[model samples]
Target: MAGGGGITPIESGIIEYAIFIVLLPMLAFPIILFLGHIFNGNQTWVKSA
Candidate 1:
């Protein structure tokens, strides 16, 4: 039988959490801006009239 290490799960979970935390904003900003442009009709480069 094979046994699992104790720290591996925690380490992987931490790594995943860190990635999610870091990427959430990185992904969200662009998506929010895109949606704002699409739904709110705001220009990306220019102010709206």
Candidate 2:
């Protein structure tokens, strides 16, 4: 396991968690921007930037 013999369940779970952790921020930013635009069409925070 430590020397890369076979894939362990714990190792797979860690990879899954790592993928989710990396993706969440990427997903959240777009969703938040869309929601903010929808809710505040005229006063969008993104417009100032």
Candidate 3:
């Protein structure tokens, strides 16, 4: 099941999941910021971390 980028279907799926794994933690920052704003809180320190 070869596709574009020379990646097989299995390899593409693995890569997609791996990217999601890596990005999931990085997405926490924005979620924290949004939640903070809703609670009338500030997250200046979270931005630095």
- Predicted model with the maximum TM-score: 2
TM-scores for the candidates: 0.49, 0.53, 0.38
What overall lDDT goes with each candidate model?
0.79, 0.83, 0.77
Where does candidate 3 have its weakest 10-residue lDDT segment? 40-49
lDDT score, candidate 2, position 27: 96
Range of the 10 consecutive residues with the lowest summed lDDT in candidate 1: 39-48
- Name the TM-score of candidate 2: 0.53
Write model 3 residue lDDT over 1-49, tens digit each, in one string: 7556776789988977998787988999899988877866456545534
Off by over 4 Å in 1: 1-8, 41-49
The lDDT of model 3 is 0.77
**Residue-by-residue lDDT tens digits, candidate 2, 1-49:** 4586889999999987898888999999999999877878565454654
lDDT of 1 by residue, 1-49 (tens): 7776656777878887787888899999999998776867546667867
Q: Candidate 2 vs candidate 3: which has greater lDDT?
A: 2
